[model samples]
Target: MDEPARRGRLPLPHRGIAFGGDYNPEQWPRETWAQDARLMREAGVDLVAVNVFGWAEIERSPGVYSFEELDSVMDLLHEHGIAVNLGTGTSTPPPWLTTAHPEVLPVTREGETVSPGGRQAWCPSSPVVREHALRLVRATAERYGDHPALALWHVSNELGCHNALCYCDESASAFRRWLERRYGTADALNAAWGTSFWSQRYGSFDEVLPPRLTASAENPTQLLDFRRFSSDELLEWYRAEAQVLRASTTTPVTTNFMVTAHIDTQDYWSWAPDMDVVANDHYLDHRLDDPWAELAFAADATRGLAGGAPWMLMEASHGAVNWQPRNLAKAPGELERMVLTHVARGADAVCFFQWRASRAGAERFHSALLPHAGTDSEQWRATLRLGALLDALDEVVGTRPTSDVAVVFDWQAWWAVDAGGHPTQDVRYLDEVHAMHAALRRAGVGVDVVSPDTDLSGYRLVVVPTLYLVSDEAARSVERFVVGGGHLLVTYFSGIVDENDHVRLGGYPGAFREVLGARSDEFFPLDDGESVALDDGGVGRVWTERLEPRGATVRARFTDGPVAGGAAVTRHEHGRGAAWYVATRLGTGGRDALVTDVLEGAGVRPVLPGAGGDVDVVRRDGDAGSYLFVVNHGDDAFVARAPGVDLVTGRRADAHEVPAGGVAVVREQPTGRRRPSEEAPA
Candidate 1:
């Protein structure tokens, strides 16, 4: 038994929240440069990510480079005491490169080459594109590697955002090679992909190509492997540039990850290892009608990727992003809530998408710290106030949240559960996971959304929802946890497949049947808007399974359905712990009831006893002691007694009332110099 290696560290001089974000001086006039610095300084901005999309301005043509304009921007920001998160500017290749080398452009699934008007239009596996991107990175590193204000080496902008699924000939070749390495031979690949289902079997690796424009739906396993390959391909590109930066400087290297549930091109669990600090750009998906909950979940997921270490909020919208269908601006005080939520989770730094507003291009309407209305605008003032508030809460940095409960929300499960051939197409792994997590949050319980590969010994209760893909090793680990007195709750569609998307034999939920003391006979998927009544006065929708209790105690039964009176939920008492199986999609009310029972059985409690459902509470353990962050996302006022002094205001009161869309961070009174726990975040 040995401790895991320490995760990556931040590149700043000390543990302090970096406060600025993507700065594009190339888009503005030189006259506004000094004004940018003045405004940043006034806002207490300490970092700026520059050169993110400046490929054209950096290198006008092949074999040619210019640093005069960038030098001015960098020097000006440095003079004002603002550090730089220098990007390689390879996200968007200049039009000259795309025009000269059209082969480097990405091709759609239908084989049409994508034009270079938008960003991330280059093929990730294109040798020509990789060579040029590496060259630019090396040149940038050699020039600014030792700059006085170099805080972080931003390898490239968000990887795999637009060009994740390139179907060009080059990608096809690369995908074939990746398959060959993964499976060793085409026969093994055919077996894994189950190509025999369509009477199509590959005799050689070359026969396999990127799944595109097939006569029918592509092979589920083939599509999954391609997703992995695409993510790894982009990761390799980032690693290449990161190597160049590490060779030239000591600055930590990272590329922002789109870890939101909406974007799934990159598997951040695999990509996180290459980054020195797991930085992520999270934008609220307003379509969900619960952007606050999504933001919290994204932060939790990103922190899990970072191994519970302090990560960075690289790019969040100042108000609304221009990309979404309907861009709604953030209400007053909403910015503070969004930023503090990340800080309350595990973010050491909070930054936005841009420092100033854009006047042209696709993002001109996107909000910024300095809006088009200038310094007198509400956005500017709100940003300024946020920066000052962050400066006062330096003690919150480098802390990790300790949770009594963990939700096993595997990304692989997310990918596999939604693939074709599922019993119910309407079932979404993320949606179910969010429902479970939201239940815990509403109950005022702290939760850590972790990967299945994570150790389960630290948690009292481990919740799994729609874990459609489970490896044998992970299954054994869960079994060991329950045997060692850890409560386990697994939902439907779990333990059905191995890592290769192959079904496990014996019964449904193959790997976990014994642990749960139950077996599912068959799946009964409900039609749209259909639901079954539960014995507990709750409704189960989307899916249900006929469960035959082996050695488990039936917890709940279906009141009316094809399998009426059958077990809908069961709890099995193992050697020293307990295991629960939920065999249906229990919509909100049902889910909340099940979660409440499990939490009560496990004795898990919330940070604040009387905290409202809309008031999110999280505790972070740092060198300074435990800090409680109480954030109210509701409209009404909420009150929570302070455990220590409020970090934002130097006030110490028995009760602290926060207004709607407000936040409060209180440091717990020290108990004679207690040491912070070094346990990894669950």
Candidate 2:
């Protein structure tokens, strides 16, 4: 409920869209540093992130430090006129520190200590690690605070990327302290965690422990609280380092957030306020059925974390990433398309994981701006082309993306909904969320993925997908939005539990049952690879429920299932607006149809009214003027009906033809007039 501490924005120098990536000169010889800077300038790069993993290099042992190499690198970069996004070099601990204090190592849920070969092996709750890491941060900030090349302060590489949750004794002690702060008394904690359920009551905070490996399912509420505590612990570590940096430098500070689909550790909605400027590292995971859709979802979610302000694509790959099961390289023009997609959503800077390919390391195969083949390679040429593209679109720097629809996504709910005690393993939190987002994208609409606590008045349509754990305040907010003449669509398994993971006793979806004018007494979870038929010629899968509609109209019913002839979908005209509920997991076509109907009722239209599903469109407005970004992902070329100068091609066109796997940025004419396009519809 309290206001979070605010830091200033990123202090960019000679700002256009800051174009560069992670540059590690420490990995190469002394002579290669000059060549890296030369090639950086040649590619129109004005910013480079350095020393992301420099702790081992800077502090070889306790009370001893080295800075000659870092100093020369900084001076060389400054001489080249390229600004530096300096890292505090505390992402990982050195061999000496871990060797001396092995107690700081993180422990697994099964009581196994994680060794220190990999990065981020230190426990987040360990005071020894914090003491050592902050010492490095203070030294780095004091050394480079006044450096002319320093443009921004990067806190750490990626917090919680590896060591999010630690079940060690230190973590248990920190968890107990955090619980005491949250609940004030043991009795209150017991009531909130429902300790009476399994004789898990605690008389004092010291009696509590982390949710370790158990015979059966652990206490669901305890598990949920552990996640919250783990996230807060990491955040506290970040704040400690940030405080050290602020004491020395006025430079804006931030850490790259891993906001991709796979990571669900830290609650970024709570972490967003601590940032001077929100930045994220995203990679295209080839394993997903729709990797492009996932990329769009991540970018939109990052924009949401920024509260619609422009953000930075801090670390994307130039081509392939080494982490996935099958590392597939980017196709021709795919990299450019992906970069422009982020820009369209609200990114002012485009950066990658590393500047040059490493000859030795775990990530040697990972793509880079300058590959092993040097400047003659296709990846290098594409990188040069991307730099040129970013140069021409300099006017779009601070513009923000606007959206009329929002998808409610909560990290607590994500943690609770999947915490091992649910009715069925078939229903997943992200699957429903991503399905909703993908459907909206296919409808050619721009969506903002926001938390439940975000203001819903700005959006015309708010979709809540599988938000199983919601607080009373958040539920009331959704109700107020609907009563204030806003449209709402809620999927199954949502509003079933409160903030403390306590079930709402009266009905299945107790929070919004009154607003939906429907109540289900029981749930009918389908078997694996099972589906039921809907009366409207649609199919339902995964879940179904026995519904009793009171003061609501049944729009669709299940034809054949355990809850046959039950209300599959219902709509209620609750104040000046309507609330729709889906009691069953609908198929793609069914879900799309329902979403289309809801959008039609809400009077929400897409940015490009007639654009195809493969063509994504986003509009950003600022002092520079309104810019429409059209990215075509389909096989055939698509004609975007916007009359203005194409920033990418530098030619004025009545209507821009965006080739397949290409992007088009149109600075619209002031008159807001569009020339008729003779081409057929895409």
Off by over 4 Å in 2: 1-10, 671-682
Expressed as tens digits, the lDDT of each residue in 1-682 for candidate 2 is: 1223222223488668889999999899999999999999999888889999999898887968899999999999999999999998888899898899999999999999999988998999999988888888888888899999998888888999999999999999999999999999999999999999878889999999999999988998899999999999899988999899989888878899998888999999999988888899999888899998999999999988987777888999999999899999999989988998899988888889889999988999999999999998999999899899999998888777777789999888999988867789988898899999989998887799999998898778899999899999999999999999889999999999999999999987889998999999999999998899999988999999999999889999999989999999999999987899998888889998999998878878767778848998888876647888998999989998888999999889889999998899999887642211111111
In model 1, which runs have C-alpha deviations exceeding 4 angstroms? Answer: 1-9, 671-682
lDDT of 1 by residue, 68-131 (tens): 9999988998899999999999999999888989999899988899988989889999999899
Clashes per prediction? 0, 0
Report clash pairs, candidate 2: none
lDDT of each: 0.86, 0.89
Best by lDDT: 2
